[model samples]
Target: MSSPAIAVENLNFSWQPDKKILSHCNLAVPQGEFWMLLGTNGSGKSTLLRILAGLLTADSGTVELIQPVGFVFQNPDHQLVMPTVGADVAFGLVSERLPTPIIQQRVAEALGAVGLSNLARRPIYALSGGQKQRVAIAGAIARHCEVLLLDEPTALLDGDTQLDLVKQVQHLVKSRGMTALWVTHRLDELDFCDGAFLLENGRVVDQGDPQILKHRLQTTTV
Candidate 1:
């Protein structure tokens, strides 16, 4: 069998050393599979995604990422640092010192792929929240990552922007054939995924197809 895109075994983490956020977590994500991480606020969903993205290391147990991961943070402000849209998207490739021509080609292709080709020369701050997120995603694609991770990716956007971002995510998974791990609290967004894991109190309390949990939650709430 092909190697999984990501694997975690008996993982545990704590920001304050003694206050654990993730406890004995075990997970494996196969290549090209999309997963939605559903959880209430402060349930460690973001923490787990951070660990998988190589931004944070678990304090105990094993966490392994088999594929290059591109992370789109919840807030685009943190990711958009360069002055221009093109510059921000080019940051990932430029750091590797690729030939200038190659970097330019990739930047153009990535921007064009996300429908932001027209905004390439525009200043980063001039773009709206959704546009910034798209640029961040374009940057990740330019890096040639096989897996993408997101944390509450649409929490700050308006309704239309949120829908556009969802379509963008679908394009990333279907067209690019990349594995995606989406973390979100919006149950409606869960339909955008095939499977989901429900988290509570920093633990995975339930998991399966998103539709199943939808029914379960509705039934219990009723």
Candidate 2:
């Protein structure tokens, strides 16, 4: 088996010493596969993703991931800072100081991957919820990120739009050979993932086989 692109070993975290968000949690995702983290609200799903992304620190345990990593927030409005789509994608690459042509090429390719080729010039304000999420993902692709950590990227979208975004992400993962860990509650979304982890009380009690995990969640409240 190939090495995992993302791995966590006994991760633990808490807001207060008594109120734990994660507890000795362990999870892994191999390169080129897409995985989802499932749990009810306040199950520490978002906290775990933040720890993996290095946005937050774990009080105990270790996190290892392939870099450069790209993070898409639950709300695109919070992640997209530029006025337009193409510009926003290019913004993430500015720190690299690449040549103009290289930046443009990367931006174009990323936008194309997310099915937003025509909306590069579109204002961020004019985009639909799903389109905004695509732009956030394009920013990650523009940087050639090997790992993607999405915190419920489709949380704000309607049903059809949610499935569309998930399908597009599945295609991108297989075609680009990238690894993705998505945090979601919608069981239908499981159909697109290679596998999933069931997070309960900050610990992963179940991991593997998306179909099995989906059935588990469907029969019980996540």
Ten-residue segment with the worst summed lDDT in candidate 2? Answer: 213-222
lDDT of 2 by residue, 1-222 (tens): 888999999999999999999999998899999999999899999999999999999999999999999999999999899999999999999999999999999999999999999998999999999999999999999999999999999999999999999999999999999999999989999999999999999999999999998887778765
lDDT of 1 by residue, 1-222 (tens): 887777778888898967889988877777777788887778899999998888888888887775668999999999888999999988988668899899999999989889999999999888999998999999988888888899988999998898889878877788888888889887778777767888777777888778999788778769
Candidate 1 wrong stretches, greater than 4 Å: none
Collision count for each candidate, in order: 0, 0
- Candidate 2 deviates by what RMSD? 1.1
| Residue pairs with backbone atoms closer than 3 Å in model 1 (clashes) | none
TM-score of every candidate? 0.94, 0.98
Best by lDDT: 2
Candidate 2 residues lying further than 4 Å off, grouped into runs, are none
